[model samples]
Target: MHRRSFDRFNWQDVLREIPPSHIATRVSFFLAGFLMALWASLVPFVKSALGLDEGAFGAVLLSIGFGALVTMPLSGILIGRSGAKKVLAFAVPVASSLLVAAALVPAALPSTAAVVVILFCFGAFFGAIDVGMNIHSVVVEARSGRKLLSGFHALYSIGGVAGAGLMTLLQTAGLPGVGSACALSMLSAVVWLFAGRAMLPDAGRNAESDGHGGPKFVFPKGVVLFLGAVCFILFLVEGSILDWGALFLMDEKGAALEHAGMGFAIFSVAMTVMRFVGDRVIMSIGPKRTVVFGAAAAAFAFVLAVLSPNAWTAAAAFFLVGLGTANIVPIAFAATGEQKEMPMSLAMSAATTLGYAGLLTGPAAIGVLAEATSLSTAFLSEAVLLAAVAAAAALTSVFRKS
Candidate 1:
């Protein structure tokens, strides 16, 4: 009976041939995703807890962006000097500390300055983890020679679903946002720490080569700039969902407080599931088609969301948005790695910096638009941005040499 069961799962035997550490590396990357999702998940709670208006909220979120921007450039330098293991071991705990600190800021200081300081800290630490983990993920993917990057990123989307669901549950139970925030922050820190020993030691080894190569840092050039723009668009879509998706449901769709979280939850699940299958999709359909079609679909989805007369249609739009966005960023990362003008590490770090900038600035940019017009108008802007990305994807093949 045992043999029969084991025989039914021959896939496990093939998977076992792959090094266990690579699997652990993937898991480590998964934890980093959790951190990103945790931050994204906390956006609504932070907005409500602070009772911020659009302008003020945008400004406050910018502090986190400022924090991340400051560290993203340094990520390659640090990873180069220290390696992914040491950098992650140090950075993850420090970042986790900041999460806990940010979560507790309401209790510590109710003033605007206090909020800025807390978010700034969160952004810096989160950026460090973001670059560090992706650096590690790229290295692991190279070693495996498989299309695992998208799947690795998918785990982050999954983390978003998990974090959002948990947050929703806690909110439903009447737990104060502050307590729930702190609890998750601390929980993620513990999870990263527990998984630390199992993680790879040389995940960012490419940083050394990048550091010694011609210029330590070079601005995006030619195709690199184009790819970065594509990344910017994709991250912007994600930022919209994170920062405003819930508000859209509540303000426009008139969803109940308990159910508002479903919008992002659906997006997160669709994105996560697609990412797991994304590698296969990319392998079969190719990156260009994936990006072109995905962006178009996403744009249409957002339009559906805006034009939809009912709440259920709005929900469906969010899912399509997630599905369309799932592979664009991963493909961009793959292109960054393939670029010859810069070392893989430095190029990736730069791409990450730019992409994260979009994340940092994108949400607040929407808020500013929302203040001037309305959330629906802001969403319309996102649809336009995504359509531009689809056009960019169609043109990407021309710059393949650079």
Candidate 2:
């Protein structure tokens, strides 16, 4: 069993026999992750330059989310017409160029209006590429008949770490934030220029389109709807942890402000490692077992976190949550690719858009719940929802026999 699963991801074959299209898909995921993280690292510098207070800054940050919302649904339609590579090739340059443009805002105008618009475009491209690249991965995985989606997702995690670490090192070396941002964004553009060249020119255009009219954007339904609903809860879990876990540790568990960050850090590291191993694990156990067991584990971890007597134990619970929930969306994507409910690219877009809606709204929703009740209560609610996610995945048509 182990050898068979390992054969699915043989390192020797990957290094020497890998096709150019596969490489392009991998690079696309990595570049998207890296560029997004790079922009994230520049937020503080932009905030300072704009002279915005906390509330105002948070409002501005919404532009990024807004950008994503605007373009995400359109991505599927665009890909169906233009193909994933064309969509990616067009979006990547705009996205990467905007990274430097965002950094340069401080020197240029320092206007809130300009920053919001630029970041909006920045986010739009990011969301477009997010949909484009996943569609590309689906097509590539289908042709290869291998369980490569999780590994492809793993590259995004690796890219995120590299991006954040690079920004940190530059800051530690005393480089100015804006300068570092500009330089790194330039490097990203250069890297993409080379890596994107091998992308499949015709991927995502051959999905079950009824004719030359291609697939129109439809709301998620059937298996696609279940996948979207599952993605919503999972992305909610992720967003909550990223945005609120530190506060929960600090206030409820008595962690120092500086050390509270370790909660999310532990989650990120664990999730990254698990993603690297996820393809093999899914191969060994299959997606149904992976989702059922993984979401159950994460739900239990949330319960542990809620009941923990101290910050350290709660952090450990979060680590478990990360490990358990790592491969969920990849499995969902793979399943969606197989469904006949809609065109592969269109289903991906609808599900992805709904999933990101959870991320964008979840943190604020948690805040409202915490204010009305308590953070622990809010977290416990997420635990319940995660359990539901597990139930939903296990019972969904994609995993269940028709």
Q: Residue-wise lDDT of candidate 1 within 1-402, one digit each (tens)?
A: 999987788887888887765666666666666666567666776677678898888788789778888888777667765566777777777777777766666555657788788778777877777887787777677667777789888776666566767877888999876677667777776777766766677566564354344335567777677777888878888888977998998898888888888888799789988999998988887878888899999999999998888667898999999999898888888777777676666677788988887876788899999999999999999899999888877875832311
Tell me the lDDT of candidate 2: 0.87
**Residue 274 error for model 1, in Å?**
0.9
Q: How displaced is residue 393 in candidate 1, in Å? A: 1.7
User: What are the Cα lDDT values of the candidates?
Assistant: 0.77, 0.87
What are the per-residue Cα lDDT tens digits for candidate 2 across 283-341? 88888888888999999999999899999999999999999889888888888878887
Model 1's alpha-carbon lDDT is 0.77
Worst 10 residues of 2 by lDDT: 393-402
TM-score per candidate, chains pooled? 0.80, 0.93
TM-score (C-alpha, index-matched) for candidate 2: 0.93
